[model samples]
Target: MDNRKTPIASFYANLQVFKGYAEKEYLPYTTSAGDVAALDAALDNILEEGIETVFARHDRIASAVRGSAQAYGLELFLDSDRSNTVTAIRIPEEIGALRLQDHLSENYNLLVATSLAQYADVILRIGHMGENAFIDKLIYVLSIIDNGLRDLGFAGNGDLAQLFIDIYKENI
Candidate 1:
């Protein structure tokens, strides 16, 4: 029940895998010519694809977070432009991350993730990378936050939670 610690180590430990050796199919780190060639080929393929995909994913997640944070009444602690898929934003100190994460899981079957040690309670990191980084998914998270905050007596308008697009108006 302690809200002070990050779950990174515990999460992996909970998997309880026997760490005797690396998986059977994987090559060992010691350099064989075949392993070297495999590594080179893999590196070449990744260098060609990873950079482009990473930028694309980062952009999508950042832009989405920028829009939703205000709606959900979250403080933008990190710039979307400078972040990867993992964007950090601040939530109410009153609604601790563990409580919120648990509430989310129990009520909406959602998992809210946090970052490192000290800022774990206040800062929730939204990961918008890999196969599931869809805009709908982000909107769902915001929606969950909206309902959760209201349930916790937050005064912010809950309509913002439903806005999936990043929109702005120009003053005339």
Candidate 2:
């Protein structure tokens, strides 16, 4: 999460012996005798694919967010050169972090928030992970921020929809 990669975790292991069950399964996890092998294989596949596919996804989403923020003249609190899975930015003083989060969700049906305790009322976080990371979804995230900033009376660089398109072209 700190790295901003998907909250959706990816793991890889080549264990010689193991008990197989979904980690999400409750304690003393039990499955029908015939299900263990299938479950193990599925878990393995998911982990492998996540590593192979999701890092590229993280890069693309992170770049889009960074690019959009840059175009809008918004400050991203994290290191600009590093690519992270999460996009964290200080919610401008006029728009409190939690307040912005609520407004975004309520008005745009986009769910975003501050996940770290230290940033609770300060930095707002947006996560782009797994298959959920898509260009349209990224544009929506930026639009919500741009609209929120405008509604709060923050003058920013104009419409970001086209910026998203340009970025998409560059990325593709």
Candidate 3:
């Protein structure tokens, strides 16, 4: 995800896999053994042929989109807060992408917290727990400080991103 080229293709790849099962088995939601087998076969095809085709198509699509974005000197960014320092760039399509990224990040944290909280034994075994640590504590902390600074209208100088690392090394 840190990669400049986001895993949008991964979504497409997974969609192809799901599409196969949806096409074969859920032909009306009435379950049948034969239908199940057909679904399995279709899924296998997706694993074999459909995946490759879909992946390639998505790769091209992403390349095209990124290239276009670059062509205009546009950039995609996530502002820490709606009002404050303007992190705006020329990137036009990025507005939607940033919203989706933030939404997904929030959803992923909630899912992790929910699952971890449900497993009490696991939680007890690890005394250090919270949304911060459960779902990428380092990234969470750094992003928070980073976002906080940005939200305060202070542009990053790349120092805040290294605070946690320095603290870790000092304690070690």
Candidate 4:
């Protein structure tokens, strides 16, 4: 009754296939055609836009998000060298992360991430990636966050959307 030889274990096994692929010697099975087609389409889009351009866009959007958070008097989880895909902000103790998240989603039709484990309800994450990494989209999200915070009794220091536009324009 060895687990290694069990049908369930076999179904999940991939080490052999991985080793073969790594050696450039074998393909254990055919890849899903739908997945391949989707990947091809995604790669085509990236090539059409240029990889560097995409990276630059992500950088610009992330920078703007960080700057907007700062302008709103929100503290970033990481003070320096933050990611170019997402920005995590400390939720005001008085306002609470879930309150803000729900406010945005219910009122503005926007969704934001809350930190996990010990940081849950302490931090909120805003992601700016791929199609979401655009000035217009970020502006809308920032505005919603700004309003949501105010609605939850947090007095922001400045307009988040305006700050994002200013920062994004400077980056561009």
Most lDDT-accurate candidate: 4
Task: Give per-residue CA lDDT, model 1, range 41-60, as digits (tens).
Answer: 76785587787765665576
Whole-model Cα lDDT of every candidate shown, in order: 0.64, 0.69, 0.37, 0.85
Candidate that scores best on TM-score? 4
lDDT of 3 by residue, 69-95 (tens): 233333423223421111222212323
TM-score of each: 0.60, 0.65, 0.21, 0.80
Q: Which stretches of candidate 4 lie over 4 Å from their true place?
A: 1-17, 21-37
User: What are the clashing pairs of model 3?
Assistant: none
Instruction: Write down the worst ten-residue block by lDDT for model 2.
Output: 10-19
Error of 3 at 115 (Å): 25
Judge candidate 1 against the unseen true structure and give its global Cα lDDT, from 0 to 1: 0.64
Off by over 4 Å in 2: 1-54, 80-83
Model 1 scores worst on lDDT over the 10 consecutive residues at 163-172
Clashes (N, CA, C under 3 Å) per candidate? 0, 3, 0, 0
Ranking by TM-score: 4, 2, 1, 3
Task: Write candidate 2's Cα lDDT for 66-135 as tens digits.
Answer: 7767777777777756646677877777777888777777887877877567678788777776444777
Clashing pairs in 1: none
**Residue 159 deviation, candidate 3, in Å?**
2.6
